[model samples]
Target: MTDETLHLRRLRSPIGRIEVVGDGRAVTSLAIERDGMLPHDGEDESGDPVLDRAVAQLEEYFAGTRHDFDVPVDLHGTAFQRAVWEQIVQLQWGEVVSYGDLGQATGRATAGRAVGGAVGANPVPIIVPCHRVLGADGRITGYSGGEGIPTKSWLLEHEGVPHTVPASARPRATDVTAAELDLPADAPAA
Candidate 1:
């Protein structure tokens, strides 16, 4: 890929520090730092408009003041990956979808594994809402952002989405039925 002028900004959030990268006009990527430290490979331009907007919106999201993001994003990825991310971005704050559901949405109903791969490859996790996806049984399969499964759990909790966390980290019983969680009848047990 050709090198482009990029701007970077880091924001501290409830989860951790997030590093946002933009190409002056639109956000390119958002990386959640595991240890509150981010690699400085781009110019730390605090005044770049796009970076500033992304950081502000993300802060609003973490504060529970923003339910959706409107900042412009220039995602670079394969066509299928882009398509998957597009569908992911349409997810509402409290909504959750399974990998199989996403595969169906993308017209690749049997490509759950491929859909998972695309979700895992999402460059902008929270912005695209990749954490909103789960396994077929409504279990959090895994996460490719921040600290992995724990980060996904925090995001799900923040959104009030009913999901099955690992047994060790679960706050409620794993056998809670859909009715108990107030989910649809067809929803998988939590």
Candidate 2:
């Protein structure tokens, strides 16, 4: 990382708390809290214009009053990752694209997995809109932000993007029991 000192600001959202990091001029990272913990280290500087603006825009986004972000960002990543993030940033508020489609957009039609890696490596999420990307079958394969799939699900639901949660990841019915299902008491648990 650069020797430049980073500034930080945190905001509360429906999904969880979000932390924004900046280097005076542009936003450098936006991290969503995972399990009530933020995974970034930065000085808690107040009145920082960049961080302030980013927080404002993010608040507007969560409030549903803003559909796009104009706050400047300083993304640090490999060339391929940059290319993927660039394309992702162009997606409209409700638009969705598959990893394969994103890979093809970056002129690497067969690099869906690689594209996923780049997408995961994105430092700024909502601003860069990496949550807009999905699996080839419009399913949420995974998410590297906040509480993982649940966090991504919240964002997708907010944007009204149609996506499917894998059966394994879907919440199981907790109120049902052997008696409710009229099954034998000795039957194997579901």
Candidate 3:
């Protein structure tokens, strides 16, 4: 049997660095990590066309001219997880949905926790919109990205989604922030 090779590529975005993976014809996964991040364990065949396209699309996204990804995607996950991720793609640009709401939207009302796990494993982050999913109390929750909840909050703000942050959720002005990405916070939301 011929082994299917997974190809990967790295791209820099306004948010941070991204690692994209593909199987020649379609994207298999896309992740946002730190500047010096490396590809998944032993999965670095960066010289592939699919990866190149993914990187290009990401560049367009960061430039603020693209809203959707057109490249084919080969998502690998259980049926439930796939369902959750599929629902994620339906989130509107400046809207946020709670995990419980997503579970109900998928007809799995009792599976909110399962949906959260699926969101955590979303192969494609921005494109699939796991960042749009919030906690039961309409607050930011977990983010697979290393920077954690802060990344989630930043993404929501960047998208112009109004997040209801608890008083304790507020960050100090000097706390190593990503807020500087788009200068002049009042300069128009998206």
Candidate 4:
């Protein structure tokens, strides 16, 4: 065996809370916190240098200083799942693509359902841009961020993607600009 161990970190952001899991050298997962996402205890490798580095990189991403992640993520799942996640990483920073569009992008145009399933199972959330995926009618759909559709809305707003929502439903994270958030909006600070 490679003696690999998982590392993790928790981050609180204006969009809500997030949990990141890494494999020492690269981030493997980035999950948005929902009400039921409690801290897990086992080998709380939260303080590991590799995990800390991943957290720092994530912070830079949130600040808009980074656009691409440069860590070796150990994605776990089926080939279809990997394909879906890989396509997500190719999404433009401020662009949104529907599930059908994602299917087409992945060369699985007829596999829209499978694409949705893969997106739902995305291990890395924000970094993978899973939030960029939407409904065929341009509506926000699911998000692993716990808030589900609302999290998708928040992420779209954060990326400057135009979306329809009730006035009261606007994302609060929008109050802060990319600069205020310390993000560059053009590239990654990592």
Model 3 residue 85 lDDT score: 86
Runs off by more than 4 Å, candidate 3:
1-4, 40-45, 164-190
Residue 35 miss distance in model 1 (angstroms): 4.1
Which numbered prediction scores highest in TM-score against the true structure? 2
Q: Write the per-residue lDDT of candidate 2 for residues 1-190, one digit (tens) a residue.
A: 5544757888766667789988889998989877658866354544489889888887768766678999899998999999999999999999999999898999999997899899999999999999999987888988898878877877887788888987666422224344543344564432
**Candidate with better lDDT, 2 vs 4:** 2
Q: How high is each candidate's TM-score?
A: 0.82, 0.84, 0.77, 0.77
Clashing pairs in 2: none
How many collisions between residues are there in candidate 4?
12
lDDT tens readout by residue for model 3, 5-44: 6577775544566677777788877777643464563554
Clashing pairs in 3: none
Candidate 1 clashing pairs?
Answer: none
RMSD of 4: 4.9
Across 103-139, the per-residue lDDT of candidate 4 in tens digits comes to 8877889997799899999887877888888887777
Ranking by lDDT: 2, 1, 3, 4
Write model 1 residue lDDT over 1-190, tens digit each, in one string.
2244657888666566678877778888888866445655354545488788788787667656678999888888888888899999999999988888889888999998899999999988898899999987889988877777877888888788888888765432123343533344663221
Over 4 Å off in model 1, which ranges?
Answer: 1-4, 41-47, 168-190
